[model samples]
Target: MKFTIILSILFCTSIWIPQNPDLTLDTRKDPVSLKEAAKNHFKIGVALNERQLNGMDDKALEITKQHFNAIVAENCMKSGRIQPVEGEFVWEHADRFVAFGEENNMEINGHTLIWHSQAPRWFFVDDEGNDVSKEVLIERMRTHINTVVGRYKGRVHTWDVVNETILDDGSWRQSKFYEIIGEDFVKIAFTLAHEADPDARLFYNDYSMAKPGKREGVVKMVSNLQKQGVKIDGIGMQGHVGLDHPSLEEFEKSIQAFAALGLEVLITEMDVSVLPSPSNHQGAEITDTFEYQKEINPYTEGLTKEAEQEFHDRYMDFFRLFDKYSDHITRVTFWGVTDGHSWKNNFPVRGRTDYPLLFDRSYQAKPVVKSIADFLQNP
Candidate 1:
């Protein structure tokens, strides 16, 4: 009877258990982070805001150090934050941001050198508030890039030299840069950024790149830059996705499209929100506004088990895709360290509760964290 029972127990265990057993075993260990899980795959990064950078939120800071191997300043490194006036550069915030990255031994990503938004109001206007001449604007741009990029040439490794220059239709967004310098603004921006730090890798970053038109536009732009002898290193696809929008097929198609080019692909500003949109609009534009309704912000109290499980499944699917293309991807960065700090709560609609990252508001690893580790480890 004892021998029969032992054989039966072994048979039942094999039927219920994972083939390798390590997959199930890893999930039982202390939560493993995206960085460690993807350490061999690619860099894992997070964007830090002023409070987190200053350590005002100690727990958020602690969590960031534990998971991220790369860091990008959420606002400190932007043009407006770094240089609000014509020549006066605000060094306090930017300095600390870089210092924090250096201390953590994280690869620092300079948020941007030239962007249509978050640029100082003074950049496009003269003393009397008239639009500046193209030559003057270009000169000011070079100076801004030189100063900021020179300050941290060796310390910061990658830079978004220009952002959101391509529209969804694959045409140039008619911004101050384009209107002032025509289409050559992108070329000039990359040139000056490279001049400031030749060693620093420069990237063209944008949102909605999963759209076929936008992807084609970016690819054409990068190809043109290469033909013109520009030093474009990578393309940053801002991964601000929701639970339902952006089918995995579309996102993967973009990854394949971008990798076909010679540059490395970076999944930047990543976040997957598990909440209903106020107006069903999917965008991260600062100017986008929506009226807050409790009905729309149902998850303000917190996500239900069903919602949480769906979020877990969505994140796992995305990471599986990331791992599949890890060879072509250089880095994958979360937009924020924790859900509490996510801009999704305020973007497109304000004061709406959202859970978008691997960490919860309490800075605890969500169940998805363990799953991500197991997925990559087992795969």
Candidate 2:
């Protein structure tokens, strides 16, 4: 009688449990199994977390295989530490990422040799609070650019040498880099990157450039560069997109505009946040509390069947666009590998749960994975 009851309980549990697709990445097999299918599709990649790779039971390379052709190191290669105190340069982390890429035959996208955020304090002010003169700023910029870029000349394939320089409202956000260096700082940053490695491709990457106002600003920036004969190779659209924001029409238009500039268009930092779908009205404010605020819960409500299908559909839409212009799109990097550790959870606004990535909690490719794989195979 006891055995019969135990068996009955097991049967009940099996019937109720939804079968999750075994999407958790299998370390035993090469992770790049999907890479072959992606070849005729687009360059599929993930922004790497070195710590995650180290913590894995097996090396990522063993499972990752030839799945990616490009990789962006998250925080290791940013401005502050690389150029911690003006002229002094550090290559410890930067070198590791670049070296790993070269060894693996992957293209290394230098994630922002320059940006308005995460900069060392010294870059902005002197010991006494006086800003560094324009000349000093320019000199510091030259030294950092030349040394960093020159050191990895051939190893680093492309660079977001300048990132997020403009605001969503179409104005330059004033950072110490901008104030001390003046307007020419933009020009100088690009110029120095070009000079450092004549063969390397240079880019000015930013978010919200799809908005009409900011798009106009980006158009002007590109036009000016062309007039000056700067070797700006590509425009990286940091595709940190939300469900309703930047409608498909807006996104497609942005792509067309950048390509029209005669530059390659790379969808860098690509992630579509699933939770917090914009309210009934566009741009409606939802209180960010986990509990329902009136009619919405900002964070995800777990992976329900409907939610899984939604993820696949959204990913398919973007993948189709990428396929439509594969020739122009050089790389499409998922900002991080898994949802648990992505920066999206606490960005733009604080204390918000954000799941804006391709892989889910178990490392298993969500329905989105199969969609991408199928697209690659069919394409």
Candidate 3:
């Protein structure tokens, strides 16, 4: 009888109960604070300049620096935009980014030097306005990579050597880059990046690779790169999720699959977009009456409360998953510093309002931040 009682007590004690069973992650009740959470986690980075960084009134930047190991300058070091006229590498923003990291002793990540979207127009054409041949493109790629990557060889810790090469449908994206330079461009870029800075880690970053098809494509790409003697170091899955899209199970599978591929995974550019429109709510009610009138604030016209809550809920839930898989995820980068400057608020579907990030314009940590902090610390 005593043995039975002892066994019962032991079983009950062994049963895992989440710290807050009520699913309430109020910051007040959060004994496990952000500072505590960040201690056990990888990194936290905000994408903005001095205005936003200095805008944090409560010395949040100092507080955050105490926790996060690294910072990524969102767009300060892109291809054409950073070095617009070619050979005239404007170091204004890039210098500031590196300086901030130095000042804080933070491991800096150079966002990218090669990507399809933000390349300068001159890169696409020769002095004669004709499409540059693959040779010239490769030279330009090497030169650009050498110049930029070389500039911060030891200072910057990692580089998103390649970004968004795969499409959402798990196919190679059809861009002027791929169309002109061929698949070899990807390999050459990484090789040159490695040559420029043999010590720095290199990564291939993309979004929507959480989907099975896209995951498979990435698996193949990474495997092929490995076989070809390329120094491809990591893969970054941009976790830009909608409330209802890519269920948690699917996301977990993606994580497990990538980790199984023997590469470090970074949950780069994570944000859950809850827009100001009803359709933004996954299960929003729709009248069969073909009324375009519902499209009021076409950008953020119809965000429902339920959807907002769901968006917030998923943000927490995803972090819980992050905590569970923290062993695999090396970093979690919030795309922007605040909702006010989020790319989701406008882009792809331009003029649409988006509330995809964790902080408001004021840099106050939102519930999502608390949720993530809670999980990171407690777990």
Q: Against the true structure, whose TM-score is highest?
A: 1
Give the range of the ten consecutive residues with the poorest summed lDDT in model 2.
280-289
User: All models: lDDT?
Assistant: 0.84, 0.69, 0.70
Report the alpha-carbon TM-score of model 1 versus the true structure. 0.92
Q: Each prediction's Cα RMSD? A: 7.3, 11.0, 6.6
User: Each model's number of backbone clashes?
Assistant: 0, 6, 9
Write one digit per residue (lDDT tens) for candidate 3, span 193-216: 999999998999887766787888
Model 1 regions lying over 4 Å from their true place: 1-29
Question: Number of the top candidate by lDDT?
Answer: 1
For model 3, the local distance difference test gives 0.70
Worst 10 residues of 3 by lDDT: 282-291
Model 3's number of clashes is 9
lDDT of candidate 2 over 152-263, digit per residue (tens) = 8887888888887776666776877777776667888988998889888988888765787777778787888888887799898887776666777787888888888999
Preferred candidate (lDDT higher): 1 or 3? 1
Over the stretch 140-237, how does candidate 1's per-residue lDDT look in tens digits?
99899999999998999999999898988899999999998998999999999888888999999999888888889998989898899988999999
